[model samples]
Target: MKTARLCAGLMAVLVLTVSGCSAADQAQNPSPTSAAALTSCPATPLQAPAGNGQAPQGPPMNELKVPVDTSTSKVIDPAGAKQIQCGRTQLKTTDDVAYSTATLANGTAKPLHLDIQVPAGDSAKPLVVYVPGGGFSSANRKQTLNLRTFVAESGYVVASIEYRVQPDGATYADGLADIKAAVSYLRTNAATYGINPDKVALWGESAGGYLASMAGVTDTDPKSRVQAVIDKFGASDISKLMADYGPQIEQGFANSPNPIGQYITGSPAKSLAASPEAVTAANPVTHADAGDPPLLIFHGDNDRVISPSQTLLLHNAMTKAGATSTRYVVHGADHGDLAFIGDPNAVSPWSTEPVVSAMVDFLKATLS
Candidate 1:
């Protein structure tokens, strides 16, 4: 069972000042500045309404208010679909469909959980594995107005996944393996869900983004192979993350679950498999060859959690590797705020029309 706990903002500073990326270079891609990169963003971004579809009619010009500063540590009972609110935004799937869940092998008695939304008819639709972010400690597959809904409506069988947290430290490797397992499961069960496995896409946010990007980059295992990747503020290099997210080094490291550390063991001379970052150079971007699938990244210029540079670096790397890539850096949107941080919605004039529109267009062009 999942629980919801109100998290008070941890005033942990995560800043990593890299020497190579200059101010001009930073402006273009803004390398991950200290993991806890804080930039004073506008209260409201250039808003836009929900894309063409049936959407809620909320107050016009809804300003995203930063939650009150208070310590609300009580673990409230998790509610149904009506209660979880990632943000005020909503994704418009093509039809009303039933959802189901299952478990996978994560070396635990408890099976890894997965919640999937199948398309309306028996017609095969592409399957997209959705990964949520929480610094590796919190969050679940809640049906918030988050990206899951968008992926669903965009003609894909959406699966909201749950991976083990870092409390035990094997979560990263288990999580990646779980993603691969999920893909295998989807491919094996495609007929039942009316999904097309060949067109699979991995969409992840924050830490989940890292998982999704890794899956996209590494296709050695047929079961874990993903045809496309949608990384929302995910990191490719753990060393880069360690360098950038300063004070909260332990926390960031914990977030990754250090699969590299667990997978490889030997003397310091055995440098081939010591740390994730060390091996990350062979990651999606590192091993980016002309044949790899395209990647679509969504990030905010003012993101304080994950630097916009992460997104930029990824986009540049993808393009350089002959992979198609599209990056959208919302001017005023912050990390985890791209969903509803801005005023753009069905009701407001300042809604996120351009961003949402571009996202849909990109998904269609690539995923479709």
Candidate 2:
């Protein structure tokens, strides 16, 4: 199952970073700190609406029932939850739409698709692209329908698009291409869907978070440029992985013959370690420009798959580069678990309420 693969591949990313990138010869795309990217952003960002979307307190199942932080957690979704419109116009979803197409490395044509949900009205709504994460190996556009429906209910047009995966030799660069293509498609056909092309944002989780972060920072092209970004527990810097998890990551690779590193980098294990070039290319921090859009980052303090330090690297880098960036560290939450909506186990009504609310708030603030 891709779920299992996503869960397992995330840990394997440490191995890939430890060994280095496959394309060691590529030149690093320098962060656009120059005068050209002068889109000044606010010094700070808005805080999450419900205090970082903390889980509700409950009695411990075993020794004692633990308490959820009621102040921070809001019950947006109740038991047997139905879609909530939040006192707005109703919404509708247009599923399985072919948004773009491209020729693959093997000369095969690949058609990309997206599922968009928007409020039913003539008014233009800001667009939010939902990028799924499966260690960049598996992508499920419908993974987080609750989040999508919730955002759409908040009067934003949300599109969940599929991108090329790492298993198919698609690197971060390729994935970004697919993402940009989707954005262009949406923008080109904005009126057809009643979309606000200028007000655009990207929201991604885990691997998708990484892509969104990259998309947030990359402004070389106007088609893919966005106004805001949301990264949920995605890794940012790979260069620091080796030092942070030296032995902790090595032992994880001992028994596994096919580690995720090779799959993502599109390189063999025996290949010489990648130089700083590949690392610079993959890390979103290296691409953070002064004109980068407002960014909201969330990471669990207890995330075992990708270290919290990873997100810290990105937030710090972007802040230093003159970008408006904010981060909320979720307490007692793990990667893509109870705190987020994409996971299958995230069925509890309150599980995603806080984060979804926070996300919608961020979008309203930035994309307005």
Q: Against the unseen true structure, what C-alpha lDDT does each candidate score?
A: 0.50, 0.63
| TM-score for predicted model 2 compared with the true structure | 0.72
Residue lDDT tens for model 2, 1-368 = 43334325544332111101112111223225433432111111111333567523221111111232223222232333322223244777698999888676677888889999889888999999999876666666766564566578778999999998756666677788899999999999999899999999999888888889988887568887888999987778755432233443433332232334443355545211343466567779888878889998876554556666677778888888988887776665555533222232322221334655677789989988
After superposing candidate 2 on the true structure, give the runs of residues whose Cα lies further than 4 Å from its correct spot.
1-88, 241-246, 250-264, 270-275, 338-350
TM-score of 1: 0.60
Off by over 4 Å in 1: 1-107, 143-146, 242-284, 338-351
What's each prediction's TM-score?
A: 0.60, 0.72
Residue-level lDDT tens digits of model 1 in 93-145: 33222222323334445456667766465578877777766555432554223
Clashes (backbone N, CA, C under 3 Å), per candidate, total 22, 9
Q: Score residue 367 of candidate 2 by CA lDDT.
A: 88
- Model 2 score (lDDT): 0.63
